[model samples]
Target chain A: MESDKKIVWLASYPKSGNTWFRAFITALLNNGEVDINNLATDGIFSSRRLFNEQTDLESNLLYDEEAKQMQGNVFNHICAKAKQRHLFVKIHDAYTYNSDNLPVIPTQNTLCAIYIIRNPLDIAGSLANHKDDTLDDSIDFMNNKQSVFGKQEDEVNTSLQFRQPLLDWSGHVNSWTAKLPFPVMVIRYEDMLADAFETFKQALLFMGIKTDKQQLETAIAASSFEQLKQKETDYGFKERIRNTSFFRSGKAGNWKNELTSQQVSAITSQHQNTMAKYGYI
Target chain B: MYYYRGFGLIIASQIMLPELLPYTLTSTPDVHISIGKTPEKLTAAGTVHKVGYAINPNEYLLQFLNVANYYAANGNNIIVEPLAGSDEKSVRLFLLTGVMAAILHQRNAVALNAAAIKHLDGVVLFCGYAGSGKSAMLTKFIQNGYKPFCDDVCLIQHNDVKAMAAYPTIKNWENTFTGMGLPIPSTDNKIRPNLPKYATYFHDEFDTDALPVKTIFIIHKDHIAKSVEIKKLAGIEAFAEVHNNVYHRLQIYPMKKEAIHFQAISKLVANINVYQVTRSSNTGFDELFQTIQKHL
Candidate 1:
């Protein structure tokens, strides 16, 4: 079998460093010129438009479960038709097995996966802002194993996004970091903030992208949080939820001031095991 | 078999498509849909996938897992093999969507993903992705005394640059009906067993003729937008708006209809006025209606 590893999965839970990393890549691809509006990458894994384009079928007519079942094939088709060396796909769906007990993302065409993990403590506050909900509600959502994004009511399943099944925060973390057929590189959000050049360089090297220190520094500076947030302020981000800013704060340990003691305890206790494994505890 | 008139063609189908106008005139059907034996795979096709489909220059095959396998050939015939116990409504829905689009593209028609409203001597088209309030605006326009031309797919004929009214039905989610203060019909009209979308037949108000293409509005809703803004697109921008709205653009290349699609879109763009309309998500339809009414 020809194992053509063409797809690089940028896997993460929402509010993790997925978009930021994609922005950095976009800058690198464009000689350190970042246009936040038009980020460079294959779109999100859950785009209904991409599915329709690849399969030549209307995704709106299919049920969510049926759509989920076809994702593996949809991705494989994407890889087969890819013209670039690496097809960087941003995915929020947890690494999960489908109804047929097979991996939702096929292993044959996968090159590598960059799984971005963040402290659930900071994530609760950031997620609250992104979802335009209460912090406590966001905390509860992170702890709920049944949590899925873009799952609308049956009456209005007309969104351009597909349903992304994201289990609880810990489950989301473990799903990507677990043993898999292909290589998985886990990057902590705090680490990326502490040493962005080193962290991003390591990820790019893992995907066999050749870059020098100067290019890395340029891309990092261009994709910095301040730059991204300012761009969003000037021209709104389409990915932003209703009335809420997408790039709220890129600070690590933001939970120190934002999250209350009760909220911190709630996130830590629920995600203690996985949090400890990733050095969050 | 049942016969219907749609997309400037007479369609004879074994399955009943309630959305299209009934064809009572005795003439040769341009397309035929029947249940028959379809090859498990296409041998001469260029692209084939494990997801149950194949495509080539003249033929396209689609298999809805556990539902049916549809084979369309040369813009004239569609062969359907329904799985046992499959319902007719589901089969008919697929036929109207992907199969019918393929048929139109095969015949070199410039079909757009738009909703058209009949004006004085032409049709005003509202084009957008799904959930961009196209249907809501269409329903609103109908209530405000504009005649409905086409609900989802608007077919523009070549040489004449006119918008042909194909199907007389409008399909919308349950929320669209309740949002418009209209009642959804019985559950039997649901498009699929598990989907909450229903088909509303508006045969009485449907214009069964073609109208000249007038103006096109590419609509979008920005959540943070404060007010509605409309801009006229000229030259390349106007051309792109029509090209981007092609109903079956993805299949054009695979079917070797690029010349046909490009020529049709190029010709249509030269004859129509295109505008981009942006509105806040919270805004009501009245402002947009009034703004577009001025342009019309």
Candidate 2:
């Protein structure tokens, strides 16, 4: 890999601050002046449209042979454009997928990998609130390997209780942290919020991106929960954004008020170690 | 409504997904199938199993794409694509394996327009838009120690695990293969010529499992610059760039499922990273490949 090009594998199952963190990092790295009220979220690494082809941008649709091949070609273009300053992404599929197989770009230029883990209990509450499924439903889907939006017969019987959320939480974290083919720097959303500046500093260092005290304070203040929410109202509703408010609540421990006792125990029992690591229990 | 089989999936349209392609069921897996066409006799092939409701033709075509034109328009994700049959030749039972992949990506787990094949190094999409360099790349990749997932066209089926592409043919274009600076399309079973009777270009001897869509590199030659350039795109921008440059970007005919299809591609684009490849990158083809190797 080229010494400068970065391959930041921002792994997290779903709603584990993957997007939230991605949004914040987007704000910070751009001009190093964080905009707490309104953050920008458009990049080759996200789901937004760079080309005017006007194709659907849903996250679960299937691609035909031509479309798939085209994606590879365009991705090569994007990687070259971003060079070392770009954010190459992976949705955390567990398998260490290397891009070199296709020979689309300078494979050796890969430089960095980053992973983010959040409390599953909190994530479950958020997903259930936003999406139609529940934590229990998500769990079964996770273990079983299917989705409510999908057909039934081919579905597996993992028997997850609110499995979607749990799986999102577990899959996102475990896939990257447990056993990785490459080195990755893991960050917890809770820990990020618990001590914003410290976490921010660590993240920068991991990327070899050094920042002074001023930049540190600026990134922190810009990424603050309150600042992000206000930005969501303005930029969140913007049509260009996939979602107007990319930032939801950044507080930790909200699981206590949001989840039912059963949900709590289910998450604790299911993801006990991970939850405990972040002191979510 | 009827059931169709190919690869390992029992494509049952009409009953389960309300949003499948509109097409009648044909028992046999025929790439020459059309949205309005159905086999005279429904031949029961267990290759495809239908468990849900009776599959309909319209929904099936809408879902798994039965026509060649429709595939040519929007099925850009496919690697081993079926040739759209010009005066020169036609591609049948085409399969596509996405090269430049994501870790454990299943971007095309369902859909009839594609197929896959796994090899030692990973997956290499056998792709091109007639002039986009599909066979040329295939021959070169093979000569460079790569394997085949499909030739010009690939076969695909949906399954419980994911959408899969089928191994078909190399159909090494004699002159074209040599043009790519590789051996003449060898007699290897993996390689074959387009057979006129079977409605396919060639019977490729090899193929692999479902690989995720990794990157998209456009092939355009700049006589002046004579180099290839690579760049990365982030978020919606990357998705848009990829979805449009796709040869079949406008295949919806009525464009009814444009939004739905875009969302589907977006999900795929979101999960994996995307990039652009300059035609031959300012460096010659080999240097371009080396450049991609070093950075990606």
Interface RMSD for candidate 2 relative to the native interface: 21.0
Q: Model 1: per-residue lDDT, tens digit, B93-192? A: 8888888887887777778989888888889999887777787788889879888888889987877788887688887888777777889868998999
Worst 10 residues of 2 chain A by lDDT: A154-163
- Can you write out model 2's per-residue Cα lDDT over B96-177, one digit (the tens) per residue? 1211010002223222222123343344332323333444455555556655455433322222122234334343334444
For residue B47, give model 2's deviation from the true position in Å: 41
Fraction of native Cα-Cα interface contacts (under 8 Å, chains A and B) also present in model 1: 0.47
Q: How much lDDT does each candidate structure score?
A: 0.85, 0.42
Evaluate residue A84 in candidate 1 and report its C-alpha lDDT on the 0 to 100 scale. Answer: 89
Measured by TM-score, the strongest candidate is 1
